[model samples]
Target chain A: MNYNWNWGILFEEPYFDWLVSGVEWTLFVSAVAWIIAFSLGSIVGVARTVDSVPIRAVATAYVELFRNIPLIVQMFLWFYVVPEMVPDDWGRWMKRDMPFPEATSAIFCLGTYTASRVAEQVRAGIESIPVGQRAAGLAMGLTTVQVYRYLLVPVGYRIIVPPLTSEFLTIFKNSSLALTIGVAELLYQARQIENYTFQGFEAFTSVTLIYLVLTMIVVALMVSVEEKTKIPGYGIQKDK
Target chain B: MIMLGDFDFGVIVTALPYLWDGMQLSLLLTGLAAVGSIFLGTLLALMRLSSIRLFQWIGAIWVNFFRSLPLLLVIFWFYFLVPLIVQGQVDAFESALIGFVLFEAAYFCEIMRSGIQSISRGQAWSGYALGLKYSQTMRYVVLPQAFRNMLPILLTQTIILFQDTSLVFVVGLADFMTSAVTVAQRDSRLVELYVFAALVYFVMCYFASLSVKILQKKMHK
Candidate 1:
């Protein structure tokens, strides 16, 4: 109960700059990683629901492989092990020559790992549509790809808003794992601030607030997307 | 595109005993946290389902707040913040353990809530027709069925908890991940040791998840 409290330390010169940069890196990494997750997840998800047995198997294997392992472990693998497994020159490029090697690996790791979860959301969305919808689309002379583009994509994505909302926010939370590999993100900066100022409470409090605000922003964004993309008579959304 | 050199199986072989000890710590954390969260989580779930708006809001806030934060942040909070609040030093293991329980409780509460909701209203009504009170209906009819239906999901979450024990590495708990990193650094066998660690986790969790799937299939019938 006798610990010193200092909220002012956060606004000081170097620490302030550190925190600003930390937030930048966090937003940068998570936003770009989300782009990868959504794109790859949509493809893998559609592939799983396709008629090609081998494609389904590959997609299923990708999901299992990514989902079964811990993200921290996968981050380490991409950061350390996977780079070493490549050709020597490329390994050097990844480990030494690459720009922001740690952040780059972290983006790759978080992107692919969360892609598996997003794929599940996407898959659930697609599969939840009535079978008759797919049958009807095909019966109307639409090719499989055209069916997905017109009917499935339009309806399926809307149905998955609730689940995908969680998945979207999860990418932000999981970006904190970048600290393990020395990405100077929010959590890492919080630790650094604590180390410098001996104000662990103040440092972490700032981070906690930043993260809570970040979550709200993400939720609000998803809510808007949900409202905009909502299909009539789908999902749990109540209508007027 | 992988070169095949600079790996020493000897390093992993020699570190086996130490790694085993670390594995025990990881399992211990998962076990203790799983048991602790289940009780707290079930209580929270009941609170959410209860008629009192106050209880419902408290449950909602607890789950939403914890679920929004990173697990790493929770670990840091327990380690750094709790000690200052209590004015006493909390060991890394206990801090990590408490963090896991509280954080996982949020997830468990959600699962339990849905499990409770999944039951047909007719079942509770049937109990009412048989002259059961609300508490009696929940205890004797609804909860038991919910637990049975939720067994596979609970097991799957436990598997995830096992994988998540690795996050304690940041706080320097000597869990399996820390042990792997330590040996990988000390013996200079980064690729080999890390690959082995990931393989061990993969085998354990992959099989655990498969079994959960099988249980789901059996429960389906």
Candidate 2:
């Protein structure tokens, strides 16, 4: 290899700032989208599991539509098409009022798309609980909502934690697609740095390392959580 | 002041040649990558499941590194880095294809590993009891069952890879999306052009998914 590998570019002040800002945006997007996806997923997941036919139908439709569409396409649709379709005042409000406008749109798009997958996981989690638990709640004179609130949701969340963590990591990786719409996240920053210095290898390699670190951190955290929640002697409660 | 209706669809009509050219590139990339990934992935899966500690570590690291990074970054690394190091002009499409194969192999390995693990340990033991070597057992018994179980998932991953082929456009390869973008830029019809391109992608992916479902049903029987 005749070419010198300049590790110093990563240490340079401006590049360091770009790297940190990129990591921050990456975390911010992942955290915000995870929260959004979790909330939306729980709601839709509950809906899907509920006995009400209409609720199930709506939830199923939502999951099918979002899951089938590509995340990039969804991001574009949210950033471009939805705004165009909205009435002028509302559209302007959305464009102007959203925090970190471009990043927010990406988060919203990624979050909702991921929520569909999370929703399915949650539904499976909820359904996996023995029917006897719900029956016992009903026998104890609790309403359906009360049974879910007091029993099912908590147990389901605990059981589904592992899969939910996998979903979060996925949403985190998918956030990189936001670069297409000009979000100055890690991948986007790398692209900017590359454009400026024409150091594509250096820029991409650094970002790849950062992503690897982030994902490893997520996996470690999830594993610890899984260990913490493991019920002794009840070998790995399987949630489909 | 370009009105949507006033714009000629003839641009799209005329760009059919370019679109066909791009489609051929897309298909070639997808096919080559799919085949490469499946081969590499199967080997990685076996390595991961091997009794040897060193092989397991190597396989684990390979899967971890590839799966964690975004596909675009991988493509960029190969496109820019490999040439600088190797002192050869690798074509943009080849770099993109190699990148996709490498990245996707990790995912396919994981899927295959899971499928293999799902099978009972007795399957392998029985082969041993029948005097088969490990390699022979894997080839004749374990892999046959594991591959069947993995067929649907592999097909699903293929659909994913097909969509991911669009990412190659970022590296300046004129795949379908890139061609659309080029034509659209010339005519300043970003929205329409992107919309049409997305429809093409959606149609391709939709059919891929549908066929997978059909195959899954047929395989199940």
Candidate 3:
């Protein structure tokens, strides 16, 4: 049976609102999760490199545990299991009083999951720097914290712009998983549009275009950042 | 108080056969998809690196498009769209396998391209100096070394592909995740089953990653 494609149906009132809000929530979820990933990953990543053995081991274990588990399972555990695990009143509060609880849980899950990835990047970035710099900082009487804060972090972050850019794109794609937990993001909206209209192809096609556009924008932004912050010889070259 | 009686290992023991069946399907998909994508990805990498503009454009567009989109969306598209394209009823298993191979070919292509390009230009030039054709040089000289160099990364990606196999649950395939969910709901022990599933996933993935690490160290050594 041939299918009659009505691309215009996506632009209709209710469907259009679904798509728009889907985009908004997708962006909102990814952006907030990125902030969480960056901050938490930075701490954990720095801790991994610290002189303290116990701190480093704990950080490493955190990365391994989070990194190894699939994100969807993590989302389920966070969404369905965690609330039930908590105190009775808190669980009720989560179910009732929490605003956009699904979104909150998705953010938490995605952020922490991506944080494991980001932590690895951060650790690699710091390690990529010359050991002499750390020695130089110490020679100048800077404490370890001051050394990382003033010297290692700035250079390492810059050095890792390319990887971080890829990580950002990854988180955006991963945000799609939030749909499984009923966040009504782009994929979820597309599924809704499909269920409503039986126009699976069109719904998925439009949302795929939005994803492509989002990733392109991220690529462009990150490339420009890479260009501006690139050190003379440390930046990645295309054919080198 | 959460009672120990509520958490039943006996239920998990009963569900083990079905869950294991699902795990087999998941592993089968990952294995097939890995082989297919690696073969196709290698071809795409060669096309991208080819001198022909048309080949380069085709390779670039395919890679970029799939790379830009989420794997879930790709799975959805193939699940719904391929049957229409092929004018035949494609089973859920076939659709998921096709979607995975196609989508992952894009990523694997990029990885293989980088691996191939990482070989020094002089190596390719020496092939030319020996009067070997481009394809022969690639087949004989370049690809072997490139594959060896890229084995660790390729395995790491395969582990990721293994994790991603769980996404097949979206299409209603009885993969591990879906099977666990089914059993959990059927048995009314969501917590125990999910926890068990997560443990299974974590153990497998952690071991795979550890192997990749070991492989990387061996290669470096």
Candidate 4:
């Protein structure tokens, strides 16, 4: 009840700059990580459903390993433990010379972790295509690789757009965890402002709104994609 | 200077007690929050399903508001805001617990809502035909079936809650992950401790997920 509320402090010179930089880092992490997730997830998801047993097992292992561990733990493992586990020169580079080591580790961590979830969605999207679709593709004299390239990948990606949008949004949220390892992302900057100004409420409130807005923007963009790429009477349309 | 050859899981052996204590707290938080959220979630789900417009709005807002923000932010908000509101210091652990329960209740609400909806309307109508009140039908007939239907998903969500308990590290809670880091720091054995923690989590969550997969398969049949 005795709290001093200062809404203006958030827009103050250094704090405002901090907020912008924080958002820049957050977007950077999420965007880069998403590239990794989308690519790796596609490969892994396809691998899981492939006819090759060993390939399927390897993809399943990849998903299980990454998905089972907590993101923070994975982040810590990547940032702290991984350097030591590698050779000495690589560890030195990671610790000292690599560009934005904290952020880079975070990108990889979030990327691989989300990739597992994305892989699941991708597998679901692909699997939902009906056995007949795969059979028909094969029956049409298409090779397995050709079938995926020409038919499955394009259609499967479209089918899973909604889930992928949420996954992309999640990477942004997960990027906040990078702060634990000293990445100056949005959440980290919010805490920095709170530390300097003691305006914890305002700092957090602003950051929360920023995250919500970011999420809304992603939803809007993806919804457009969904609308543009509407497959006539195929793929499940989940209620928003 | 450390190499893969230098990996000494002996650190885990030495730090087992601390890690065990931390694991206990982690499990305790996950268990408590899971149970609390399910109860709150059930209420919210019912409210959303209720014919009353105000209850439906309240339920919808609660779920959407929490879902829209990151859990970490919510935890930070509770940790910082509650002290100011009460004009007193709030325990970090308690704040984190409150944050987890409230935030997780939102997710559980959606799950429960879907679970309830999945139950055929005819079943509810049958209960109504048997001279039962709306509340009675939900209590005796609808909820039990919903719980049965969603047990695997509930367990899967609980596993996620267990993983999430590690996030309390930001607020200085000595949960399992934090404990491993603590020991790793004090002993200067970061590699061993982190890998051990990852393995522990991997073992528990992997098997749990596998079982959930099996349950899903069985249910499908």
Please provide, for model 4 over A4-119, each residue's C-alpha lDDT reduced to its tens digit, 9 standing for 90 to 100.
89999988899999999999999999999999999999999999989999999999999989989999999999999888777889889999999999999999999999999999
Per-model TM-score, in order, reads 0.95, 0.89, 0.96, 0.97
Best candidate, DockQ:
4
Residue runs of model 2 more than 4 Å from their true location after superposition: A93-99, A231-240, B1-21, B129-131, B214-221
Query: By TM-score, how accurate is candidate 4?
Result: 0.97
Models ranked on DockQ:
4, 1, 3, 2
Task: Give the local distance difference test score of model 3.
Answer: 0.91
Please give, for every candidate in the order listed, the TM-score of chain B alone compared with the true chain B: 0.93, 0.93, 0.95, 0.94
Worst window of 10 by summed lDDT in candidate 1 chain B = B1-10
- The DockQ of each candidate is 0.62, 0.38, 0.58, 0.73
Q: Candidate 3 lDDT, tens digit per residue, A118-190? A: 9998998888888999999999999998999999999888888888888898899999999888999999999
What range of 10 consecutive residues in model 4 chain A has the weakest lDDT sum? A231-240
lDDT of 2 by residue, A52-132 (tens): 999899998888677665666677677765665567776787778866778888889988988899999889888878899
Which is better, 2 or 3, measured by DockQ?
Answer: 3
lDDT of each: 0.90, 0.83, 0.91, 0.91
* Residue B133, candidate 1: alpha-carbon lDDT: 98
Question: What DockQ does predicted model 2 obtain?
Answer: 0.38
Model 4 regions more than 4 Å off:
A237-240, B1-4, B218-221
**Candidate 3 residue-wise lDDT at A135:** 98
For model 1, the docking class works out as medium
lDDT of model 4 at position B127: 100
What C-alpha lDDT, on a 0 to 100 scale, does residue A206 get in candidate 4? Answer: 95
